[model samples]
Target: MEAGGKMMGMQLSWIRNPQVSAMLLLAAAILGLVIANTGLGPGLDALKHAHLPFTVFGLDLSAAHWVTDGLLVVFFFVVAVELRYEFTQGDLNSVSKAAVPTIAALGGVALPAIIYFNVAGADGAQGWPIPTATDIAFALGVLALFGRRLPTTVRALLLALAVIDDLIGIFFIAVFFTESVSLPHLGLAAVGIVAFWMLGRIYRGKRGSWPLRIALLAVALITWWLVAMSGIHATIAGVLLGLVLSPAPAESARERLEPFTNGIVLPLFAFTSASVIIPQVPLSELSPVFWAIVIALPVGKLFGVTIAGLVGQAALRVPKPDRMKLSELIGIALLAGIGFTVALLMNELAHRSAEDLIVEGTLGVLAGSLISAVLGAVYIALLSRRYPAVDSTERTARDSEEYLRRTDSE
Candidate 1:
């Protein structure tokens, strides 16, 4: 039992490592691209599109759909838990702390969409959401590479902005992308959500409640199914169920599930989503949808976040201590453009009907994200030189002394 516990601990620690997860995702995308361009392309393509019919659920989904709609739910569930914590207890718990990031996130969303709309014209307008996402894992992994001496405020700002960006992305998925909503199925999903909430109350802190765990799983699955039938994106079910669960149990679930999500679900999704045939056409012949996302993600995010964050900081009179310098905000903005996972998902959803446009958009996301990654790294490395690293031992001792001082006063 002890050995098994140790193995589980190691697995959990691995999942928590942002740099490793980012590298795995990057590796998966590269593998997919290589496989798709090789003689094995046809076999991989067949595997991706092959459908397994399920009459009971009235579903006949492709293998790729199973990865996107079913397995990706685990990723969204973890995101929802993080969102809940941020709103309730973390940096976003107050208006003062949340103001700049919220405004910056909105600017990040709006400007990219506007840029895409103008660049792509009316026919390609649906792809506006493609550049609006920020893959927190990728962005933070890049930050970790050069931010060892950066101020704590820079990381905090990035985290807040990313969380808000995710919230906006989820809203776009639920509102703008949903096809047709079935009231009856949505109602059923609500019922499942309520039941899950009730069970969460009963099961809170009951670490060994296997029966409760089983019941919660059943409810979650039912909710996902109902949402899928309702013509809503099925991943929203994961978000709703995650938000309704009690915090302790929800966190426990996230920790337990993170390994599978990081190791299997995300990498698989990345591979499947990226396994597209490269267009045989020249650069001039590529669709406007491709060029739009390519330009919008990095340029749009940099301008949008920097301008909006600066304006919001000025307008709100954010304290000097809390306010980020212009360079720091710009660095974070560039980092925000590393929209690999969520941007790719949005690309698939937005251009699902246009096969050529889908391929173009995928390539666009990869290229744009790569550019952002390189530029962000350079900017962060330069910025890091301006700040010296804090001594870990001294910082910890200082924090402990402060805490004791406060305790004595209290």
Candidate 2:
């Protein structure tokens, strides 16, 4: 009974977390900015450039690179695994349910790119991808503060929107962010994925076997290396490897993985990948890159997602959350604009040629993320009214089913 009570308390807190997680996320993000901006300026820089014993075949890597490439690989793997799970059994399972968020994601992707290109692309539109990021964990963490105030349907809707956003972000990274494609190597990557898939089929019986899962993990890492060497962002390898290394849908292996993703992978990723040192601000002159990122992330994402949601609703009557009015919708959309992780990647890839742009872009991510969190938190807190928790549990079950369907699907 004690254990059961604790579980219920956690779930209810998660369902209506009184904004604890959300506040934590915001605090962490803001703390990152403070660390970067404060007097430890030189220390942070040294840490980023610090030499690590991260040697592989005598290959040299810095602490920052290790975080971005090595540790963050686990992050992307978690995301890809969830994506696969969703397709098999969760929210993306049915066409009716999937269509609305998918289209919303598309609109969200398109508008940000267009806005960023037009605004920051002064040098022939180079930093176009900077705005196409939606930092889901940060936003959802903040939403946790509202607890029972948010309807389960709305929560599910927000999650679906973010996942779809991630899919689109992955595609854009593959196509636009690559410097040049090495076809021969790319071919090898394709072969590696296919070969692994075949191996997975042979290993199907080992879905729940710990030893087998361990072996496959090593193979997936090797495959990831090959894909990264092939000039494709190594992140795609994480996604593709997930598709091949997935457990059979009927099994319950995913729930086992869920805790790690939520508790460890995301938090670790946030901690490691989020250590941006705030550049010296000329508070007087925020660069165009800064303004572009500021506008593109929050304004563009909100504009794209909210309008897309409205349209999807009008066209297909995508069901809205019960017991909450339309005001909650805007809050959800605002949170969608908090593009931290993905935006950081785009800042790395798109702004590579101009380090200054990367610095400015970081500022935009910080500002936009803060505004979105504050506004979303406030909106939910103000509007949270009496409502039943049935919908929250219902969505949880549905999400699980959708996840099951995804990993099992062909």
Candidate 3:
């Protein structure tokens, strides 16, 4: 029993690591791709497209939709929890620390869209938002693997930048993807959200209360259902609920739910999203959307983030000691291009009408993200060698202590 318990503990520990989670996501995606191209492709495709056995609130969702619209909401909820923490206490608590990353995130978003517009023209313009995201898990995972000897500031800047980029990506999803909105359902969702927030506040004072926990879970599901029926994406419900929940309870929820999200939700989403049969055509015949995403993710993010971050630092008159070197900034900028998860969601939403475009978009996101990961790893490794004695692990430990102190005081 002791040995089995130890094995389970080790498995949980590995799943909690960002590096391991990222690798799982990648492996799932690759498995999906391979499966889609194999003799069993049709079976998997049919399974993904098949409707669920049951329907709630008169909504029938396919397996793929269940992953994206239902399970993926947990992932978004975690993101929103982190975003709220940053705004209220962490790096983005002050404008002085937030400006550069916010500016750089905007640049990272804009340039990719501009490139997409120019390359895809009117035909594929709907996918402009696809490449404008930075997958935080993948970026942080790569950094953790390669940034052993780097300073803590690099990770901080990357976190801020990725969080802000995702904020913009979420905005795009909420704004651009809605076909129609039902005011009645939306109103009900708003009420549910208010109830959720109030319950969270209550839970902060009533920890370990199972009834309250059950009520919270019930209210969250009701809200998500209302959002799904309201014609807005269901994931927005997670964001709204997370942002409104009180701090103490929110932190607890994040810790409890993070492992489930990392181990199951994200990997399921990735596998479903990437299970696209590669196009059989030559490169020249591929959709313009593919080429645009391929070019925009790495190149657009590199130039846009580097230039805007440099400019923002200069304009804000940052201290020399706080400013990152040009080379380090470039490396971080390259890392910003790892836009796997959100990009895939955007692609699926944008090209839902055209099956062929969806296939091409999947390939584009995977290929582009791979390029960014490779280049970013190399760049970060070179930077690590320059500061061999810095010890990022020690810096991370210090940061964690500071974070706990801030949270406790708050």
Candidate No. with top lDDT:
3
TM-score of 1: 0.93
- Candidate 2 local lDDT, 275-366, one digit each (tens): 56655567658677777777877778778877876777778864454222456667777878878777777777777677677677777877
- For each of the candidates, the C-alpha root-mean-square deviation to the true structure, in angstroms, is 4.0, 5.1, 3.2
Q: Which ten residues in a row have the lowest lDDT in candidate 2?
A: 249-258
Candidate 3, 105: how far from true, in Å?
Answer: 0.4
Candidate number that wins on TM-score, 1 or 2: 1
Give the residue spans of candidate 2 off by over 4 A. Answer: 1-28, 52-55, 207-210, 249-274, 277-279, 317-325, 386-410
All models: lDDT? 0.86, 0.66, 0.89
Residue 388's lDDT within candidate 1 is: 77
Q: On residues 1-410, what C-alpha lDDT tens digit does candidate 3 reach at each position?
A: 32353344444655767788889889999999999899989999999999967886699999899899999999999999999989878899998889999999999999988998999889999999999999999899899888877877888899999999999999999999999999999999999999999999898778657798899999999999999999999999999999999887676677667789988998889999999998889999998999999999998999999999999999999999889789888988999999999999999999999999999998999999999999999999988989857555876677466644533543
Model 3 reaches what TM-score against the true structure? 0.94
TM-score of each model, paired residue for residue: 0.93, 0.82, 0.94
Consecutive 10-residue window with the lowest summed lDDT within model 3: 1-10
Q: Model 1 segments beyond 4 Å from truth?
A: 1-7, 53-56, 390-410
